[model samples]
Target: MGRNTRKRRTPLATKIVAGAAALAVGGGGLVWANFYASAHEDHGGHNRTRSAGAQVATIDCPDVGQKIRDVPDRARGEVDGELATMDSQITDAYQRLATTRRAQAGDSQFVQNSILGPLKDRRKAIIDRIQLEINRAGGRADDNLDELAGCQGRPADQQQDGGGQNGGGQDDGQNGGDQNQDDNGNGVAGPVADDFIDINDVQPNSRNSRNGLAADGDGGSTGTFTTDCGVNENNLFNSDNLIAAPGVDNGAHHTHDYVGNQDNDAFSSDEDLANADTSCQNQGDKSTYYWPVLRLQDGTQEFDANDQGGGAEGNIGKILKPAQAELKFVGSQQGDVVAMPKFLRIITGDAKSFTNGDANANTSWSCSGFEDRQVTDKYPLCPEGSQVLRTTNFQSCWDGQNIDSANHRDHMAFVQEDGSCPEGFQAVPQLQVRLAYDIPTPTVENGQVQNPYAVDSFPEQLHKPITDHNDFINVMDENLMNEVVDCINRGEDCQ
Candidate 1:
């Protein structure tokens, strides 16, 4: 009697309903667990990505950019080192030359010696090479500096983001309540927003104020937020836009008259100025301009013929005459001295009637004439105690005396008006003229010769004459030899 119902068992419909409800609850739990696992996996998978992001952030540091931008300055230091080395070499050469001159002062063999020719030539070549290298290095440094300056600012296109949220629901004040569900019946959060990140903040490799994220739950939600962590403004790798520090302008070539003058005249033929302008254009400087001859010496004046008071054809002599005349006139009138013109030109309408003296008389004087009277065997003797004497036995004579064979002569002047040899038609070696008169003995110092004459020390003029061509070639060879030796010692490329 306890209930015929218990004996009869539960109805089939009721059992089926209970089983279905249990299955639905279990399925909901499984889905929740899967969602949690997915979130965790996403975080774990992003470890490498986060690490990369951090590295990029560090490079973005403003200091790193600044450091990279300083490359030109660093290069300049290297150039300075090279220049110092060149300077040392030049100094050594100069000192050696000075010492040699001193040691050879009283020695006849040394005084009239041609030993320093090769060394002199080498010095000039070295100087030219060093100057060229300096110019190249300086130009490179300037270009690099310009590139660095352009990197200082931000990119043209920038964006902002707010992390993983919807654009609505903040005003509802529904704390922890799922007022709205996504397509999958999951609760959705309101929009997350952030402020703009400043460059200073990002300079120290800190996180930027623009952080964003995407999440998938019911439908999907994106999260965006900003942090105050600074940007890496100093990262040279990332900061291609960083500005570089400027360099000091050295005075080299700044005071050269030709360079200054060329800059002033628009019609100047200087190719260097044109090259400079082109370089400026390539650098994207639309407004860049240069003016030449910026400053003039005191008391300097420019005259224009068109001006009313420009005075007397703009002649320099006329302009300076007043001051000069006053001084002369005052001296003559008050100081009992005649004030004569500093310079005078005699004007003769006809050459034949200019003077009463014999025009064709042999007025030319000769040192050899004096020497002949003093020495019997020597056709032309030099003055007593003369260190070097000119000998006519050589190609060209100096003041009627024979040219010295050993001395490096730089220039020669003939006693006669015309530089031609006597009508004998003797073939004169032009090289002898240069070697005897062009180069001068090196200056001597306290009883010692510091720089012994080398094949490379000849004057530039000595290289020109056809007869001296071999000597010139020899000098060049000696220079090349020395340079090759130096290069080998330093482990540098040598030709």
Candidate 2:
């Protein structure tokens, strides 16, 4: 468990970046070396599979999970180098992120947006390097992150009690229920007719039962629309487009699905996005709605265990497009759907869920061909013809005013039992996203998959499959919103 304390970052970005350069050139040469050369090296060939009897155990303080002792020497050394340098820098930056000043007003927006997000990127990059080394070393990583260089994250129960002290344990955004439970714990359906099943729910018919439910309303005023954002192609082209808060040109922390605005980021003005080209088929509709990219991993992919670098470009390298992009929009439950303001940044889900075992990762998994079975703790190993599927739903009720909030979540609330917006907020178009993929069956060791599954995430994710979630933002043109309002107010079904 993590101790309750505020983590302070004393390292400057320049020092970390420069130190990273020095390490690449063998500057600190073993000065910070923490691991001894694995005795298992030269054991004949590379990619040697470990025997089921291979021993794995956690070392001491700072390190957390059960470490695999069968790693190759070269790969172990590579991972160690990153741990001493990049991982060290990442730890410092993460402390800075937890304590940084939030809320950008006017011109200060530049610094406010630039601060933590960049650190997030750097941390993710460093972690990606570690994951790659582990993959090359021929060892699967344990999701508990017990093998991290100096990071000692507390369990969720400890995190909740520790108040998220220095350099470990996130707040997890949980209330009432245990945040550590899968998929945010027993999900409460919002005002939508039939919301998708929470990915981590273990109950049977979790998917099928909900799929059959119909959205009911006064038959006028509000309407929901879903679109297909084609699966992403393999490329470094930035797609994590929140365009605000940690505003960068290419969606710095993670990539996203861009509908409008050729150039989008936190600094982008509504006019710029409205005038820019779009990737969406609705050319007249200059709106950007995006969440994290979902991917299917083969054993060869360098991954941490959870979806860390949420963007498709950086850590994931290239991602095979999902079978479909399930995008749904919602308006008021009883009144006419109102028009959304231009350049609205509405984020949902925890993009960093790749590293957590809390409610944020409350995921539900399934197989493409086998729809009846749904698993929560771990994804079902898809058969020869089936593909693994993942889905996440965001909160809907809003405070009726604030476009963005301090924590980015306080202003939003989930709909009540009847699908009505909470007392203080009116419903806008609720955005629920779904992603599909094809994955290879992982190697099982001691009754567990050895190769950690990675989402485009940072090195610390530990590759735990249970931790899965996403984020979102809505940047729509004024006219396009009017069309949405019109469709909802008049009960017209238009794509």
lDDT of 1 by residue, 251-292 (tens): 011110111111212112223222322111112111111100
Residue 201 local lDDT, model 1: 25
Give lDDT: candidate 2, residue 442: 42
lDDT for predicted candidate 1 compared with the true structure: 0.18
Candidate 2: stretches off by over 4 Å: 1-152, 155-202, 206-223, 233-236, 239-245, 248-261, 265-267, 294-318, 331-336, 354-364, 369-377, 443-453, 465-467
Report lDDT per candidate: 0.18, 0.40
Q: Write the per-residue lDDT of candidate 2 for residues 270-339, one digit (tens) a residue.
A: 5555576666566665555544444333222322111223211223323445666666665555565455
For each candidate in turn, the TM-score is 0.13, 0.55
Model 2 worst lDDT run, 10 consecutive residues: 183-192
Model 2 lDDT on a 0 to 1 scale: 0.40
Q: Where is the poorest 10-residue window by lDDT in model 1?
A: 324-333
